[model samples]
Target: MNKMIALMLAASASALLAAAPAYAQDASYKSLTDKATADYKQAKVACDAHSGNAKKVCVEEAKVARAKAESDAVAQYRNTPRELGKARKDVANAEYDMAKAKCGDRTGTDKTTCMNDAKAAKTAALADANTGARAGTNVAQNPPATMKENCDAMDATAKAACMTRNAASSTKVAVEDSVITTKIKADLVKDNDLKALDVHVETVNGVVMLSGFVPSQAQVKKAADLARGVEGVTDVKNGLKVK
Candidate 1:
């Protein structure tokens, strides 16, 4: 009888152990679902408040949020033997239909173009949804700005490349601004204090490449240092000659 009781207790402990993970999974699923639902509701409300092209864009954004929510719910359901996958696909289809309805009144090339644009937007939205499901939602909304900041923080050549890839307009402005600032600094050096000194500032790929002549090593270092401090200069290539 003692042996029988021991076996029953062991069986109960094993069952509880098995159930623990299932319980944990359920809790996790619930949390994800609640957050996703809240995001979708917020998006819907925002979309409904706009009009015209802005409204269209807002709706597109909301669809992306909804897609993400549905995808998360479906993924959680897949582990529990539910029909949530089918429901998620249905939600995706419905989103497509709504997009089409929103864009239907557009006329001429605008109509066809609008439809194509809507399709592309929906595709991108789905991609974003997938990314959010894996990495979280905030990353999707702020990627460009975050990438630009990271690029700006890099050293010289790499920073130039990063800015080129991530922020073209800002990079262009930075390069031009560096060139102008370099010219100003070069003009400030006392010409009589230096001889046979020529300052050349060339910008390429958003990096300042300084080439020319200076009277002394001090002037050379000064020119390069000034170039480095200019906004948008990824690097300062010092190729100055000291007489």
Candidate 2:
């Protein structure tokens, strides 16, 4: 009975460890978002001096600035090459939007040429983003040496069992945690009221921890609620502080 209990505890611990997800612990997402917003506002204010097509172009430029800033922030927060690729693509689209807006100043064949040039630029940018995405898709690697070391002390049969369990657990945990984190971040960023950059997300097993600062208690609650609503999230520990 004692041996059985020990096995049960070991299995529990393994499950817990296996569910944990890896993430970037040091990225400052909030500060970047804030700076982006401030810069966009300043750019928009500068646009007030212009009129007609110039003002339209200026507004689109401001949008481009905001899009690029947020893209960079998201890429850093995710710390994944695929996400970085997507961010770059988003910037490209924003630039295309601004370019098309600028084309409004011309007429006849000049405007047509301008639009074609904008499309070509966007296409080139997307090609670059695709290359980045392909490069990042191979991020998965073999299980850590520690997992093998832990199994080495066991008898042959036990070692085989341990290795198998560790390998399966690691793969499952990584995939699950990554999906959960991505979904939660997407939800947070989409919410108009929530300052997503202000929050830090980490997952251990199926449990999520939200850390950092928000503007109000309501936002803290909202962030936690949003996290909890995501699939595969077993629980949420809200560590967000009111600023």
Candidate 3:
């Protein structure tokens, strides 16, 4: 169950970690953080009744839930790569804390192994967050105009190949993401089943992000399935908030 949770966390973070930068912090986010903190206090109060190791686990679980709620609120409010990276770290930290607490339930070397696994998971999540931060910084540094200038010197055939290169990030996954985004957009334009929906698609490192409002959950599923069916898509992040 813990492993399943970690895999889901990996998937969820990868998609959300791709975002544009925010120029200014907003009051709405402050309000959300306050609410989340209040909720955490209430949850902790409720968890106070449990005893011993159970009490510790309950406290950790409450903290984890609160951390997730707070992170989601931050990401939603800012929708920036930096904020997303922080959110990912916050979630990973919360999960790691819970995992460590759970390790108390184990005995001897088994406990050591569990703690080691938790550390590995935390390290991986932090590394991913760091990569996302670097990717965002690279995009900021390498403007599209510079890439266009570089491609301008190539022959028509060479330029055609070079055009597939991502101006955002130079990773191979970015190349696949570029083609996948274009194909998915084209598919949306021509597919009759998706006619009723207005979806915006973006891809970062082969993870497709579908935003904008959808008519229904069915439409959300349809859009996600369509993107998943695309050849280069590593994963689909359905952000289509239903109406």
Best by lDDT: 2
Counting clashing residue pairs in each candidate, in order, gives 1, 2, 0
Q: After superposition on all CA atoms, what RMSD does each candidate show versus the true structure?
A: 22.1, 17.1, 17.9
Better of 1 and 3 by TM-score: 3
Off by over 4 Å in 1: 52-60, 76-88, 101-105, 116-243
Give the best candidate by TM-score.
3
lDDT of 2: 0.71
List where candidate 2 sits over 4 angstroms from the true fold. Answer: 1-27, 137-243
lDDT by residue for model 1 (104-204), tens? 66688877865775565446434433433454322112233433557646799998886667656544454454465455455545444433344534443
Q: Whole-model lDDT for model 3 versus the true structure?
A: 0.69
**Local accuracy of candidate 2 as per-residue lDDT tens digits, 1-243:** 999999999999988776553322233677788899899999999999999989988888788768777875764466466676777677778777877887897899988977887787677667756865775522233333443448877999999998788877667755776688778878988999884444556554566757544567899899999999999898896755453
Any idea what lDDT model 1 has?
Answer: 0.55
Clashing pairs in 2: 19-205, 20-205
Alpha-carbon runs more than 4 Å astray in model 3: 1-25, 137-233, 236-243
Better of 2 and 3 by TM-score: 3
Root-mean-square deviation of Cα positions for candidate 2 versus the true structure, in angstroms: 17.1
Score residue 23 of candidate 1 by CA lDDT.
91
